[model samples]
Target: MNINDIPNKSFKTVYKGIDEMEVREYLKEIKQHIEELEKEKESLQKIIDEKNENLNNFKSVETSISEAIMVAQKAGEETKRSAEKESERIINQARLHSETMINDAMMKSQHIAMQTEEIKKQSKVFRARYKKLIEAQLDLLSTNDWEELLEYDKDINVEAQSKVDNIVNNDDNVNN
Candidate 1:
């Protein structure tokens, strides 16, 4: 039998034989106590195991959450970088377009200025030629040719008046 099933018979018997019934009863009660303790131990061990499992699950969930946060942060950083790059590209393209427009405007301005200069030179030459033509006409009109023509017309009128006077005189003599 197990040690708990037996009674403690350490002392010697005194005259009558030792009563085993009381000892058996006591040993039985002690065995029952030991069995109760074992059951309590098992119950406590199960609770501890359950609690440990819960703690492990909690740790796993915490790790997963941490990893998720890291991934989200990385994605956010990538988005920010991509946006910055795209903005820079757009700005550079705008700058190039504006520069091209400015360059075109400058070239057109230079062409217009050159055209204006050429027009000015052409106008200057035209004015000089026109002035020279007007001066030549004035010189032609100022010559003695117009005066001689006027004198010739006066002489013709005087000769016609004298012929009329002679005719009138001859008529008067015929009438007398």
Candidate 2:
């Protein structure tokens, strides 16, 4: 029977009533049973202690895991912040560069416009000068100098005839 069944025990009495020796023997057995229960209680307490230790270890591991998760989250937030700052810096740099390029292009456009205006002014001056030169040429060609030119041509014709006469006279002499 179970050790817990000791409390419900009932002993049968002898004819003269309960035997003193049997009572003593029953007391001895009950004492041994109490000792055995004490040993079992100690053993159960040791098992309980071991289980408590394991539970504490589990709690510690859980705490460590929680701390690790927190650290990782903090690191991720820090990385995100760094990336955002870097992106902002890059966007600002690109904006500045684009503005510089636009300004440079505007300056070049203004310079080109000024140069074009100067070229137009130069073209007008050249056309004016060329027009005056052509008009002077046209005026000279339309002049009344043709009479003087005809007289000069007559003098050239007379000189050429005289040379021809001299050549004929020399040939006649040579033949004689």
| Most accurate candidate by lDDT | 2
Candidate 1 has an lDDT of 0.89
RMSD of each candidate relative to the true structure: 6.7, 6.2
Off by over 4 Å in 2: 1-17, 20-43, 153-176
Per-structure clash totals for the candidates: 0, 0
For each candidate in the order shown, give its overall lDDT on alpha carbons.
0.89, 0.90
Please give the distance, in angstroms, between residue 36's alpha carbon in candidate 1 and its true position after superposition. Answer: 5.8
Model 1: number of backbone collisions: 0
Worst 10 residues of 1 by lDDT: 3-12
- Score candidate 1 by TM-score against the native: 0.58
- Could you tell me which residue pairs clash in candidate 1? none
lDDT digits (tens) for residues 83-159 of candidate 2: 99999999999999999999999999999999999999999999999999999999988887876788889988999
lDDT for predicted candidate 2 compared with the true structure:
0.90
